[model samples]
Target: MASFRKRGCTCEKKKCTCGAKWEYRIKYVDRQTGKTKEKSKGGFTSKKEAQLAAAEEELKINQFGFAENGNEVVLNYFSEWLEVFKKPNVKPITYSVQERNVRLNILPRWGKYRLKDITRTEYQKWINELRDHYSEGTVRRIHSIFSSAIHDAVHEFHIIRENPIQKIKIPKDVENTNRVQYFSKEQLEKFLNSLKTPQKNAKYKHSIQYYVLFSLMARTGIRIGEALALTWDDFNEKEKSISITKTLVYPLNSTPYISTPKSLKSVRIVKLDEQTVKLLKKHKINQNEVILRYKNYKASKDNVMFHQHDGRWLRTNVVREYFKEVCKRTDLPVLSPHALRHSHAVHLLEAGANIKYVSERLGHASTKVTADTYLHITEKIENEALELYSQYIKF
Candidate 1:
């Protein structure tokens, strides 16, 4: 219950004749102490405003058993919510992206605003501004993080009654056809061949490791993190398969660590080709020789299959940069290391491999995902199948 009173009123009976501000004193039983406690706020221009503010407070108390700080800054509340609810449950790399979005996108726009005071119109305008600046995918990710946090505020914390960012329009992104997302079969061959070619200015002495590393990705369609997390123990020599159960979490702002794969499907066994198995075996021999030459050197704690000379996990950036260099030297289109995974998938699909098998090999959640990602390839395959049927009917 709340009582409204006029402040600094010289003549106060039922209504004040003097122009005075209004205040409300709300009394509620604190659930923790089982005792009556009072909360009061002042400086409202009218009695109605004071009563409405008190009613909002009462609603929060009734819903959540306590009144949250209605004046809490948006950034401060979001930071706390992210730390308390999000960080522990998500992967380090995923948490980093959310943290970055809060800092770069959300905080700068609404940090200083009171958490309960943000209006829907203003939020929609801000979203529109963001859509103009960022790609649709990026804008969606940003919006998702912000909207998720706000949803918790409404339903979980009862900090706000409604989400301001709900149903905001996002502009569709134009596909950049000129940008190369993956390598052609010939380009992949050239890139892999160049990985084995020696360079005078190369920082890493063993170029064979690069060849084996990239070859594995191009053949297996595993993520770069999954490839980096491999250990000798993961390989089955007789079966010629590699088990993928974990991935490397390489965060730009923190130390790298090993974590579980992206999903349950990602924890699978990928069969290796005869040539790939031979390449890995030969690389193992070379690695063993290097270890034998330096008896005093210590092996990496994780015993990862790929590492630097000092037995540290190879930085992801180093691999990406070197991959670009290899592409340039081969006169191929410069693509990220992840392009190898895409190349592998494209080659498998183009070679008449089953979509389900490709999905499983790529560790996708479903064949639908694989089909959607390579929709153009599926269309091409459809056309080719029809052409083959037409040729057969000519007899």
Candidate 2:
């Protein structure tokens, strides 16, 4: 496996630390390049350390059929790995994000360090520096990319024995700093009523279709993407349930495409209130009239519930921009369209819907996620519970 022997040096030279030292050497064949080379290490204080190092190296070589690039600089190696290994295996959206992080953030900062030389302390300092400048979520994402790269180096390339990125202590407060806002019942009614009755000067273009689109998200807590992916086929009129099996994703410069909902639970059936069902009925009749202009496009074939009046898929930004205008007109706090889903969760949970059912309605993979996200509502519910308990205390 590995060879270890005593290496002799002339003690006559004043610069020499010792007359002899432990030496280890091995021959390793390159798996990808198809070449063989001698790998050697020297200058250990004891033979045991030298032998152990050599043994580890030998094991790495044997397992992977090549010598680990432990000596390679971190940047050059990871850049190549990202392009060659990671990009092809992951989805386009994932590849685009990871590639940007690697190229711009990770490599720019740690590209010079050698793989084996990156210590836990060194990474901790780097992370601390990152925390001061970037948001907590961005810093965590960069750390995840670095950790995944090191994990691959260990399992696939046998380059490092451990992942230094994982050992860094993460700041707890640095998680999810996104500003979340939702409407109270009065505010929601005001906003939706503003959409239906536009002021004379503003001339809001909201129709039955936009009204149904926004109402459905508030009613069912479905993501905008999931709502956009719906078709006439997905709605069960008799059962009054909507099938949420797919989502629409539109990346820039690419044709719009339908993909499965984010998780298995995302593909579910959600019952609709009668008012919402009636709204859909009126919207469907209006949509049928609009689709007649597009001779080549089948509205049902396109599988879009809220297809644009011009027979095109509605991009995410289009809906967001329209909602922004509606917010300005309504004299309401400006919130993204996704806030409707959050409002839905908060409203459902406050009305004493079971937590598990709310989780399923939101298509969250777990109730824990639902509980954590709508924690404000849970706190209110806790206070209400205490009031109910007080009724029994007057014995």
Candidate 3:
């Protein structure tokens, strides 16, 4: 005989069916694909209610299938997307940078999570955790990679409704600015003076390269990569100009690679001062002497501007370490290779160089960036204004 139980069940455990437990299960053929799918609803007060819930879910699945939830697209899918999307569309160097961010940062965090389920709150929490573990700049770069990946998911996979990162604010820290520690003029002079003395440390012979590199950077405002990429051919001794068409870049765990300049503006020819040209000629002669001493070594015109004793290209990391040692010996502030670039801009502005000319020399996309960044050098503006006022005033 069929029995009807009226008393409701409060049992939450799956196996417990002590009371009038109502469980319903359904199997239906997808209307569009004619595929069999099974789903279940349980612990309802009544069978009819469970049936209704199951029907609604079945309808959603039948209409949208996996698209209804981003769970269907896995981490492997996003990885594939990143590779294909970046290879054809972005420059190799840019793609390499993105690849490192994805592998080292993004994948470890949200790779297993579904795109649709990645909410702003979840991202914010993850970002905060990352901030605690890593530097702000690193976390910011990871955020950019995740944001770009999610954006591509929307456009390519149609899996995400919108990018979750668009609404969330990035973490900020003091190091976000272009400002870097720099040697004072007197300290710089002292450091250069110290370089003239032979060091007790044989490894410190390379210290001279730091002086030349830093001095060039301080005078030219060129990026570290651009400085490393300079070649004998790029320098015109007769014309006193430097053609900046390429830059050196080393991606994480990869060998150094050369790439085009940062932008069209970065490809301009910069005129060198007389003193700068003289220094460059001296450096060139020194470099040529070293190459001649090691004639058996492979040295080609296409090689890097700077090289090690083995005739290998000098790694940026090695340069940075040498810079640190020099700073310590000279009792100067510890400044990064980038600080020289900042000093260059500041000194040029202080010497009454116009923002437009500075922008061109620095290869900035616009003068606005140059003006905004070097606004601290107001002495130039004051001197210019005073000169104009003197011409107009009548006593």
lDDT of every model, 2 decimals: 0.84, 0.79, 0.71
Q: Residues 91-184, candidate 3, lDDT per residue (tens digit)? A: 8888887877787777787777767778888889989888888877788887887887777667655556777778666567656464445556
Q: Indicate whether candidate 1 or candidate 3 has the larger TM-score.
A: 1
Per-residue accuracy of model 2 over 113-201 as CA lDDT, tens digit each: 77888888888888888888887778889888888888888877867777766767766454444335799888888877766664566
**What are the per-residue Cα lDDT tens digits for candidate 1 across 33-125?**
467879899999998899899999888666545335455567667777788789989887898999999999999989988877888889888
Candidate 3: regions farther than 4 A off: 1-68, 72-74, 174-178, 203-208, 292-304, 378-395
lDDT: which candidate is best?
Answer: 1
TM-score of 1: 0.80
**Highest TM-score against the true fold, candidate:** 1
Q: Report the C-alpha displacement of residue 382, candidate 1, in angstroms.
A: 1.8
Candidate 3 TM-score over all chains jointly: 0.74
Measured with C-alpha atoms, the lDDT of residue 359 in candidate 1 is 97
- Cα error of candidate 3 at position 319, Å: 1.1
Clashes of each: 0, 0, 0
